[model samples]
Target: MKASEVMADLRRRFPNEPEYLQAVEEVVTSIEDVYNEYPSFEAENLIERLCIPDRIFSFRVSWVDDKGKVHNNMGYRIQHNNAIGPYKGGIRFHASVNQSILKFLAFEQTFKNSLTTLPMGGGKGGSDFSPRGKSDMEIMRFCQAFIAELWRQIGPDTDVPAGDIGVGGREVGYMFGYYKKMAREFTGTFTGKGLDFGGSLIRPEATGYGNCYFLLNMLATRGIDIKGKKVAVSGSGNVATYTTRKLTELGAKVVSMSDSGGSIIKPEGFSEEQLDYIFELKNYYRGRISEVAEKYPDVQYLPGERPWKHVKCDIAMPSATQNELDGDDAQALLDNGVIAVSEGANMPSTPEAIKKFLAAKILYAPGKAANAGGVAVSGLEMAQNSQKLSWSAEEVDDKLKSIMKNIHEQCEKYGKEEGSDFINYVKGANVAGFMKVARAMMAQGVL
Candidate 1:
């Protein structure tokens, strides 16, 4: 049950898939000690089985551009596991999409869904298609083509797909329309659909709000109040804006928000009015973070830099890309007296950064436990669709909060060390999530 021995085999087997290997290593290492305690698990080779996905569907997506130019992109769906429930995860449309990234995302999704206490398995799908700079028509055509191949492998009780990265409401709408047309059945096969359809209320704000709720729970454990706490949040997408919105509502100051180009820094923290402006900028106009600087003369935009370097706050939320915050950024946040870190994005903090946080004994909430809110709401959407009903915004929000609180509790149960008050959330999340999935796999037997 040595972590090194298992990691060596995974590295050998997945030579080119660094992201997937990293994800597997993190979980295996975290649960190795507990895994050893279960001799039956070792005999059944549960870890080895878990490392391999149940199935992977790969196909080519062909679409014509506005100018009638034909384009082809690789699309994939990694259906990792389904012992607990149906396959569930998001579809990321970005230039960085690949087998490695999607595999890592699907692997992480297995645990993230488990943390929600929802009956969802793990799956992820996407393409190397970049939606940025593409016109509305071009994006639609691309999405329709992408779903043409994906429609067959997914269904309401099969693999339920949501949106991620460049795949937003528009993209999801396009894909869902295509799926509905192709399948000739209108169902809750997709989670992030428009509200006019089967989408759940507050689904867009679920992840962000959930992160804060988990953060609040973490703070409560330490008897530290969130009021008057200055926070630094990165990314200008729905996750970032909504996280800022929730933090602001909870009496915390969110001083920074960032994008690929740079970060927008406001020493006095952004207001609800400003967040509205940002929402319109990113969501409606699809503009850059620099545009906020032009609209508001107070905030400064650091070109080609992450907000972590300039952080001066009590909390940090990296809602951007994977490994965006590294060891240096962790040091910067620590130097600025950051007491907690809530990750909104999958693997936002690098292993090095996570090590620093663990060493400093900060209240660090991994995305698996912290960002389960979105999927929790997605799960609610599934239930609503099944029951032919729709819950109110308040109902969905209450459910999401309860799910986040439960995830935090699970982390606390597994994360706390013997005779030590410090909570290792990463270890907690991995062990807790693995136990459920592993038990299910063992009972289901060598599938």
Candidate 2:
């Protein structure tokens, strides 16, 4: 299939869904040549089928606050594809959640799951419900209400939904509890459940830890040691916090972390104590990142700013939301002699920023391959649940490391330049993942 023609048709059909369309265009552009080689794939219109989700579930979620006021929010679940295995992805709860965003996320999850070498398909569900400034009881009520509309559509083996953004362990617990009550059977229908109820060890830190592992692989190719490298990681969530922890353990200095409000820069590098404080600030107290500045005299908070442009570092990890890093941010990193960028968030870098990274031939790893550790571990959790047993933290951590290494190797194998040392990880990840899913679809005969 022609990339331009496919993207043009998609644009016409999905006129206002820029995020979903952008995801489609990126994958199709990278895999077009390989896709054209399979005549059966073209005859079956596999590319088109892959671009669209299998089904989308939209419902209204209603919940009551502590004040006895009722609220309504839009909830969605995009089951992108189940060609290889069951649908598996996260459920986000943020004011910004929408069809376009979840569609893009689900589409990206397809390839990300494929790269993990796990038996899973792509799916994403979320609501436009903001968890910020909400009481614990309110959040729990909303989670139950959200799941009430979706429990029937999901199962342990059908579609396993995990946590993302505003939905964490607490949200997952509430939803899973409600789902268990409604279904009247306890199953691993949802991942990221609390450890008390079948959650895997290191599940929260998997994505960040995995990104660091992938970066090590990338850096190792050039015989560069991670010991003395300075890293600027954005976002103060699980991914960002754990990324800092792992980097510090490896002797790298992480200079910054950020949230929606702004960034906190600790140029001397954050201590383990400082990282823990930031983590508790966000995860527990739900305080603004700016509070870090008030607590520590050495830390500087930049209001309404991201850490990329202001920090001079050897590596940059965009652990924040989608499109938070742009071409200008990329150029600034490049100008400051950044050697590598490993995404810990899905699609954190914009198209232009990716192009700049590719043109520069730096060790840039995309989210699909780099940030897949979370889902990889989720797949592990599924396995553990099926076995009715839990693996030790060391065992799970080993598996996570092995998976990240394999993902990095896959990128190297498919993304290696014909004659140059530069590797195009984006093309590699897309092509490799597409090939796997395409072959699976072909074998299944146009379902």
Candidate 3:
């Protein structure tokens, strides 16, 4: 598990694939303990096969905006691996889309899907087109254009896409509508659809609620509870909002929340009414977090700062974008006596930040494992689609809760072996995910 050995092998095998290189590095780092434990994984050349994606598709999406100006965007679909089943992941619509990021996400999705123990493979697709501030008609046009090409590459039995960062319920609805029109099928080819369609009831809250469920399990290991604890959460989107709601429901006082523009600190705790108003501005009105301060003068808004820095909390959840919390932020949270950190977004913490949290012995949960709920529920959606039946909201929520608990147990089972009381979630997630795919690959034999 030496870095030199890993780098050498990776370079020799995937000389031109930098995405493969980055992914291999992360996978190796996460499961170095597993390599040390087994050694045969290296001997059998499993790393080489796992490093290469099963398939990669890139295309151009040309759409006309409301102004009748045509815009060109790059689209990607990386089917990282399909050993378990069909490709399953979200289609992110952001200006930051690229092959490297998609490859990394698809690679990560492989394990994330595996962690759910569902019959799903790993794949992701999207365009480098941002949907922010676009008119509903413009978005619909863009979605239609995007799906015109993407529909040929995906389906219910082949690859299914849900919503990601810039993609939401509205986008999903548009895309699904376009797919239905183009394919002349009412089948469920996507998740996160409107409830009127095949969408699950708790899909919006799945990721955040699942993350809290995992954190609760982590705390339970030490006989700790979330009741009456203080929490600071970043991001006002679905993940952060739902995390706040679930935490509040569990008797936690979430005093801080933020958006991309700025952070809001309410020392008295954020009321559900205030949160609903914030959601109204951000989600409905598509405004900034500063609007929260304007609406409720009681809430103090801090400009140009992360919420974690100003709030002292027992739990800190970075549900924001990737690497939003860095080393300094981790140190600040640790110094402020934050007991636990769970990522509700992919790779929300930088390597240095995670190292700092680990060094401080804080309970940290990585996004791959903690935020798998969205994809897990997506898999469930797929099941319902295939079975031509829809589960009730309560039933879906019960299933989601059970899956989160199982994921936590799996993490603890593998993470506790190294005498780390807090659990090495990275190791746990990677090992658990790797074993399932590894076994499937072995059974498939040289594909």
Q: lDDT tens string, model 1, 368-431? A: 9998888999999999999999999999999888888899999999999999999999999999
Which parts of model 2 have CA positions greater than 4 angstroms off? none
Whole-model alpha-carbon lDDT for candidate 1:
0.92
lDDT of each: 0.92, 0.93, 0.85
TM-score of each: 0.99, 0.99, 0.94
- The stretch of ten residues in a row with the least summed lDDT in candidate 3 is 14-23
Clashing pairs in 3: none
Which candidate's lDDT is highest? Answer: 2
Ranking by TM-score: 2, 1, 3
Better candidate by TM-score, 1 or 3: 1
Q: Mark the 10 consecutive residues where model 2 has the least summed lDDT.
A: 266-275
User: Distance (Å) between predicted and true CA of 317, model 3?
Assistant: 0.6
